[model samples]
Target: MEGGSSTSGGRSWSIYGRAEITARYEILGSVGSGTYSDVYRARRLSDGLAVALKEVHDYQSSVREIEALQALHGSPNVVDLIEYFWQEDEDAVLVLEFLQTDLETVIREGKRRDGGIEVGEVKQWMVQILRGVDACHRRGIMHRDLKPSNLLIGADGVLKLADFGQSRILNEFEQIPTNEEWMPQPPTIDQGVSHPSVGGYENQAAQEQRPFNQEDYLQQLVDFKTRYGTNDADKESNLQDGDASCLATCSTGDMEDDPYKGSYSFVAEESAEHESGTLTSYVGTRWFRAPELLFGSVSYGLEIDLWSLGCIFAELLSLKPLFPGTSDIDQLGKIISVLGDLTEESCPGCSKLPDYNKISFNKVENPIGLIACLPNRSPSEVNLVKRLVCYDPASRATTMELLLDTYFTEEEPLPTPLSELKVPSTKTTHDGGSLGEFYNYGNMESDSDLEEFGPMDISTTERGFSIRFS
Candidate 1:
């Protein structure tokens, strides 16, 4: 996609082409695509300001995310969406405020190269994440997906929650409606005893029944084969493959007819709608999958987000994912190993989840002892992790509880804002040209670059103040 100029209402503005935006963002040089959406580093042509751009192919998903983000503006801890553009023939482009790094990068770097993050720093990071999440919840929104990669660190060292794509906005009555048309319905079936020679009512049934579309069935079978890589013949003969669990659950009576069954669907229907309000879908990096989702809970809400946060926090502390299973069953086992077994008493609502009856439970072994796994963590740090990782949604701590925890209060002051932090100047060759012994010229070049790369001529004071990187 390329960014270009466009007119909205009566005002004219330059919009970078989708392709141009991707190139300008310069992310191609840093990391391979890590998300379903294509990401890039982009520069605003009007003022030459740098920002990140994400191009979404699905129009519905794009609009949903944009609406959610617009509601979150003015939040200190939330990542800001600078601008968005859509055209009939092109993918939606979301221009976002650029950030220096994400928590995932920081964790990996600290673990492999610089040892682990200091205990105080971990507490500070958690405090920032909780504050951001709290702000969202206060505004009647649930992040739904709270992973390390989604937490972005700005150039000013401020942590902001990005990716509202999976976020859900609650109304004043604290309810969200589900789209009924997307719900899956149970398949009708006929059952009867049969004998070898008794071809009873075959012709009569053919005359009374509507003709089934073989092509449509074939297409569905093809899609299933492509997704699961299972042979159609094998599926026809016996549907016992582990990979077929999701399909089996959906096909059988185990799953609900309503798609939004596990979501927050009880919100009153007559409540006033915000300028924009809608429930988002399940979206998160693979490793952060919540047990409720994996087990096929239909109407789950913020509890899923808390699960992801726990996983992220654990990874941050141990430098390894707490549950790194490859499949749903494996993922559940990983979680069970850490949290102990899930019994009827421990997980009261387990039977309500789809496919719950299919799997049997055994005494779960704690593979990695909490403190031993996070060898670098202190006692307080361990306590915080336990609170966040609680299996029961009601038992999990709220954002406020986390922020007020002793970890953040007792930690040393956070690092100075990146905007105020000075960058040391060092002599270097520029395009094979020597600039040494030319102090006056170097100073002039620096000023010129600053002016050219500064904020747009339009005042952003109304929106927010810019952080000056010295």
Candidate 2:
């Protein structure tokens, strides 16, 4: 679908209309854009309620997103999808409850001001996110890509889950593809010397060609472990020294002195049964990928989402992404270095995973030692993070548990509700121009003309849209 327009008339209408639904909400300006969609701030012509409109590129993907939204409508913790429509020419428009800003933006801005998000505020948001996720889980939906960017804060201080593009409806027979096609096959080893063979008792000498570099294959396995496996020496040093400042520094976005900068060292080479270009193979953003996914586990589930939550929580606290790995493999290394390693015994079905055969690690690392990495973090905060980021899906804390954690309850109270936050009702006038002048309907022939522009000319440039109440 084409993006919304930014005309002054469009803005006024968006702010004042009450019962009117139009081809476009009339974009005040671009809010955000991704590979497949663009989001804009708009208003309902009927009620004048401000909303965000997402215009998607692919009809099928848009349909899927709408289905996810339909499943989440009426959910207090989810951004409400009020309605959606397909214009005459197949342009899809989804009207969403508007949010003031996203969590990532808020956290980043706070960092620039040298201020940290209040611990209490963090807890409140965490609770809201969990509430939304819990609702989704009850409906058998998994938000595969749960991250800070997807969590938005309304002007009234309400937190809601926004993006559903990567979400999936889970069921008994969900057809998750395996990763066997993505990983390289292990080289075969020769058991003995080849002997003479004959098809029909006629002597014929045959020599085995031998499989590709077996030693090199073994070395690769060793390298994977050495790089990703937790180092006891490093852990012990941190424990003995009790130097958490270094760890805290790692959590922040400042990466100027980081060792693995400007290198594609994180993502491990793996082939999927599905091609890389396909939607399913596109794992989440590198910084937020869970350990199982980073390690190439094919049968992974919602625990990955929890892992991302843990990372986001850490980032929120530190004003940076928790593990800023340049590649997938490196990302795994950062996780292991901080949270320790996972073994077959701990992760019971791990070996059965697609990339399990490629792993050569023998022992799992200790979880307690890993907690020390978050310098100055309270025990309650660490406990919550660990519970949310557990390797075992069953062991991972439910969203409800996270919401009720003591870190939020004892540390601080929830922020004032968004409805009570004092945001200006109108944009500031510039250059002595009155705000009403931009949307002055002086020469407007009829409301019908604006509504009858068809699908192609729907555009707006106004700062706000108007909705007239009866």
The digit string of per-residue lDDT tens for model 2 on 1-470 reads 13333235333222123123343354565565555565667765556788876666555456556666665555678887766655433335567887766666556555656446656565666677777776665454667677766777766677788778766654432221111111111112122211111001221113333344535534543443343222222322111111111111122132344332333123322232123322354445666666666444444445566777887777766666677764333455556656666666556555544343432232334543535655676777777777866666546665545655566656645543455433323322223222212111121111111122122211222311111111
Instruction: Please give the CA lDDT of all the candidate structures.
Output: 0.51, 0.50
Candidate 2, after superposition: displacement of residue 463 in Å? 58
Model 1 weakest 10-residue run by lDDT: 439-448
Error of 2 at 261 (Å): 21
> Candidate 1 on 348-452: residue-level lDDT in tens?
666555445444345665545566656767677677777767666555666665665556765555433345432212222223232122111111111111122
TM-score (C-alpha, index-matched) for candidate 1: 0.60
TM-score of 2: 0.60
